[model samples]
Target: MTTYFHTAAALCLAAGMASAQSADVPDNLDKLSNFQSTGVTEFTFIEQDGRYAEGIKRTLERITLPDGFKIELYAVVPDARHMAVGPQGIVTFVGTRKDKVWAVTDRNKDRVADEVKDFAPSLTFSIPNGPCFSPDGFLYIAEQNRVLLFPAAEFFYESPDVAAFNLVAKGDLVPPEEESFNHTARVCKIGPDGKIYISLGQPFNVAPADKLDLYNEWGIGGMIRMNTDGTGREVYTYGIRNSVGHDFHPVTGELWFTDNQVDGMGDDIPPGELNRQTEMGQNFGHPWFGGGTVRTNEYKGEEVPVEVVHPVVDMVAHAADLGMSFYTGNMFPEKYKNAIFSAQHGSWNRTTPVGARVMVTYVDAEGNATSEPFAEGWIDENDEYLGRPVDVAQLRDGSILVSDDLAGALYRISYGE
Candidate 1:
């Protein structure tokens, strides 16, 4: 792997050279590949000016956590979306809604990253928003219209070229004609059954009547599961509008996911969703009911075909719940054990922004669940977003890493500080 100091000088020189040659760029994917293949390893850097640093420090001070817990800036990673910690505990791979995925490392075991560089710099990524690793170290990244698996990614990611094969080829994830830029953020997880589960978000706000059958048949508005090699593909859950995060329960092995509700409804009417699926082929309401039992404007009078499963917890409307993970580590107090940690990316359309914080959901042995805020203050007193939390992932040392795309940074939250 390239060290921090070596990559810094190389990246700076490459960036300067690229600026000089901007007039001869290629077109489309080829252009993306050429741009990434250049020696520019670090595409973005954290602001180090006195004013920006002081602002971040002030924001950190204003953040409120549970007793005995603390939060620190872990690294500056641009467009950090979803995260997957390597099995060897050496690196954390973070994906993005853009064209880059980052590999962050803490060589000194100090909990702060020493280096952050582009992962798989030789290839072009199209909204590679979700990445997951199997127990044996196979890394799978779900792109906008494809899925790629890298065997032994933990060991090979340091090299410029990592061995990879397509699990789902391009134009195969969804129909090429039906693809839309809206709601294209795809996420994946390895279930307890050892199958690769991926969520496909439908493009339309409420799928049109003519597109419903095709969307259902193509698994566009649902969750699909397949073997590691991408065989045995089948729809696991359906009727989902746009889900960007899901994880299997550590004990019951059931699936739990966060779904963003339909927009254009007033700010506080239809809430976001945290849904649970106990069996295969389960359906969560999308068009028929916006979030909970509230009917949507478009599909209000339509006949419901499948049973609509309500959410385990209803979040505030326009919260934009995105990524989530179950807390099974022992670093936190006993109360946080087995609880769910999720991120609300915050709202863009609301008059006042809400949910730029981390939320905790406690589920009892009897399956009842209750949720409350675990971390807050990301939205300032003036309603401006200081930082937007995108995804939550637990490190090997029991601390959790939260990715903030808005601030272009990652934060480590630890207990017993």
Candidate 2:
């Protein structure tokens, strides 16, 4: 054990890592991979039970799910935008729009996370809002301008440092000129083809004439997939405004995603979208058609340049459809089998707030899709948001976890035992 500790200590922090990095925003990934120490030991921890956490639990009581289903506070994860449950079912990593990726563990498997702490305290993360695990247990974090891969993350997360490296280096995921915090919160998933797919929301309300060629070539307004080692990078899905959530069909293996619509077109003009991609390089109509064939004001009355595939579900406008996952677990009733569970992040500037709930969709044999609210009541009678759900992920046991950035917590939904 001593020899192993010495070898691990020599692996990530050779010298004092802080002295070698910038004082303002410290990042020692290269040094860590080179077998050196960062000299940073302080870690931020979120209390599991306290007054702040009690408030989040109180809000969960208001969440109304279908009968026989229960929702409870899973963990207190601040700014938790997305989640990736480990293959071993040991720990769940939660990402944020800010700088931290939380490692939440339920040591005894009680279904309530007993520990919530920052993962890799030595690294500086900017908008690390997407986390996904490979079947072999490699964790990939999609950041604003980088993609990081943590090998055996579930096993190594107990320490402040672990085996860390970049799958896509900083400024290489997208061009520097295209970097904008506005719509750059990336989400990633390991696809059925064994490739890592990531969503790149273009940093504009509408794609301009000058940026069309560049955006099309670089997949700035779409999803891109690449090998696990970052090779074979290519655009898979094309021409959508901003998609924050995507998943693969279990039986068919096709890609499906949700896209947020163009704003300022009134609260009810162009609808938000839940799209299905049967083929690669299929354009979903960005500047040409806002959402569900509603033409964007910037490109009104012009023949759309590319052939557009309309969305499978035309959601309510400005509902801000974000993350989604297919219901593959058997804990819920048979009706939820193969259903799509997604989150609507609530309307920002509408006259009266809407959404802030979880939605369920069922696709029939003939390819028709129908959607309805599965869990709701986060929006109060006073037009205020009690919680805004961001993403949905399933645990090893069949229960699903919903992340809320507004309330900064994770909630677990389970069916009858």
Each prediction's TM-score versus the true structure: 0.90, 0.94
Q: Write the per-residue lDDT of candidate 1 for residues 1-417, one digit (tens) a residue.
A: 333222335445544654564445332333332333434343333332334434555677888998899998887776689999998998898998876788888889999887777777656677899999998888999999988887877886676556667889878999999877899889999999999999999998887878878888878889999999999998899999999999988999989999999899898969999999989988898779888888899989889888989998899999999999999999999998889999999999998899999999998886778999989999988999999999999999899999998876788999986
Clashes by residue pair, model 2: 11-35, 11-36, 12-36, 12-37, 13-36, 13-37, 14-36, 14-37
- How far in Å is the alpha carbon of 315 misplaced in model 2? 0.7
Q: Model 1: which residue pairs collide?
A: none
Q: What are the Cα lDDT values of the candidates?
A: 0.84, 0.88
Best by lDDT: 2
1-417 per-residue lDDT for model 2 (tens digits): 011111224313422352354357568898778758888676666667767778888888888999999999998877789999999999999998877798999998889998888899889887899999999999999999999999889998888878799999999999998899789889999989999999999988887878988988888899999999999999998998899999998888889999998888887978999999999999999988878988888999899888899999999888899999999998999988889999999999888888899999998755568999999999988889999999999998999999998888899999995
In candidate 1, stretches whose alpha carbon ends up further than 4 angstroms from where it belongs are 1-55
Q: How much is 161 displaced in model 2, in angstroms?
A: 0.8
